[model samples]
Target: MADIDMAELGPDRTLLLVDDDAPFVARLARAMEKRGFLPETAESVAAGKAVASSRPPAYAVVDLRLEDGNGLEVVEALRASRPACRIVVLTGYGAIATAVAAVKFGATDYLSKPADANDITNALLSRGEAPPPPENPMSADRVRWEHIQRVYELCDRNVSETARRLSMHRRTLQRILAKRSPK
Candidate 1:
């Protein structure tokens, strides 16, 4: 991916990048540094919390999964520590619930993994500079059904936990699962 133009980013901004993947974090930190940010990294959620508490970043790029805990915990803590900071959640192919929860927990945006540096740069300035998330082609019902399936997998086929996590009644989750499952 091409480097982002740092001239576009405002001056003297700080960015905190939290990702367990050391190589990925390094690359992104380099890219953001080129874009004029003073980027710091935390390889675990615990370290991220410590950094955030000591000096909140103006923006944070958080991966949805981490070694010690889910990145949602870090995202929530970051919000508490720096409500003024902009957050962007990084999601893998099948982790939509976590991504959605990130937005609900106050992430400024969410981007799918394998995203380019351009994507990261835009997310940083997304709050007032970028366009709104475009509508999905699928219907609301279809999106709900898809999210239910992802939740089921995330909970390791535990219907009760899936239901609770999705905020649906247990029976409702069962009904949805039944509809999607083989006879």
Candidate 2:
């Protein structure tokens, strides 16, 4: 595949990527490095903050959730350290409230989790009010299914706890969990 036009991000093109998913971050960092960014990675909010404080990067892709505290704190620190930094907030949680807060706190754009390298590159390069709606938007049912799955995982896949938290009947939650994800 062709690489992104990382030149648009300017020279040296340091990128801060903060996510707790080691495998995902490692893959994304390699892809971004191939695409022309010198990527700095952190698996937790503290590490991300330290990296940002030590040397503010021009671009940052931060996960909304981390092993310690929220990524929004990193976003805040980056904005303070380098007001011009372009920041994209990615989250599997995908809630409007946090998205709004991210923008309010200083994110250049907000992307849902599973945002691929291309999506992230585009978001990092494009300075805009918000990143474009995903090229292939998930269908409503599919989005709902994904949200349910995210909550399920966050709740440690406990049907009773997930149901109680989601305010759905345990059987209903179980059925949803048993079925395949929507397309």
Candidate 3:
């Protein structure tokens, strides 16, 4: 992770990280703490909202999907409690519509998973400037795979429904889902 300057750490360095993935959230919280943040973590929308309401952090990293509900609800709660909070929306299912919605909910940035600690930190600390292009952008094939996987998930992993929605052959969709994601 890139070292963040102390001056840029803001007046309050408390950070809330909300993700259903327990291991990911724990790892990220540890990483952020190493960078001088006082990190709090939640694994569900309800918990996240409760934490936000109780004490809105100075910054937050929220997943778009949670086991209990949409992470956007948590975002909204945080924004309502603390308008100045810098929130970054992170998700595995990245799409333009969701990204726009995240911004509309007062998120400072939207990042697709699996974003590293460095990327999250940069987004959190950015001063409204457009971020530089990704050092290693996803390939077209990877993007397609991600989209298909997202659709498959949305369809409750039904092969036929996912294929029909994507206009792809059922067998082809099955093969893609069976294989590991491309780099």
Candidate 4:
């Protein structure tokens, strides 16, 4: 990612990056530092909260899932500690439901996994009214898949339980889950 001008970020350039993926976080932290941000890192919800307790960073990038708990916990903590702080929720399992939930939980924006440093930086800086909606949103199949996966997580990945809840045959549900997410 190209290094953004520090002047554009203003004095609020401190960032708290909360993600369990060590390699990805390391790369992002280094990239952000080069872009002139004072970056702090936390690998779990607990650590992120601790960092916020001292003082919320001017911005935060929190992964949607962590070893300890949901990354929304970190977002809420930052919002509570400093409402002015900018927050972006990063998730591999992107879905309309989760994206809406992230924003409802105080995330300024939500980005899918594999987001570049520049992508995150841009999202964190964007403010005010939202852009026009996508002309073509996700397909029904994709939305159903996302909802099934979310329910599977809620059931602690119990295939039978999720199948029961969704009124799906066990093998059918398993097959749906096994397939890669539809575009």
Considering every candidate listed, which one attains the maximal lDDT?
A: 3
Cα-lDDT of candidate 3: 0.95
lDDT of 3 by residue, 1-183 (tens): 687887899779999999999999999999999999999999999999999999999999999999899999999999999999999999998889999999999899999998999999999999899999998999999999889988998999899999999999999988899999999
Model 4 pairs in collision: none
After superposition, candidate 4 runs with Cα above 4 Å error: 129-183
Q: For each candidate, C-alpha RMSD in Å?
A: 7.0, 1.8, 1.6, 3.9
Per-residue lDDT of model 4, residues 19-120, tens digit only? 998999999999888878899999999999999889789999999999999999888889899998999999978889999999999999999865788778
Q: Rate residue 59 of model 4 by lDDT.
A: 90
Question: What C-alpha lDDT, on a 0 to 100 scale, does residue 155 get in candidate 1?
Answer: 92
> What's the residue-level lDDT of 105 in candidate 2?
97
TM-score of each: 0.66, 0.91, 0.92, 0.72
Clashing pairs in 2: none
Clash pairs detected, candidate 1:
none
lDDT of 1 by residue, 1-183 (tens): 545566656664899999998999999999888777899999998998888889889889988888798777878888999897888888654466766788898888888765667778777776566565544445677667777787787899999999899888999889888885332
For residue 93, what is the lDDT in candidate 1? 43
Question: By summed lDDT, which 10 consecutive residues of candidate 3 come out lowest?
Answer: 1-10
Shift in Å, residue 106, candidate 3: 1.1
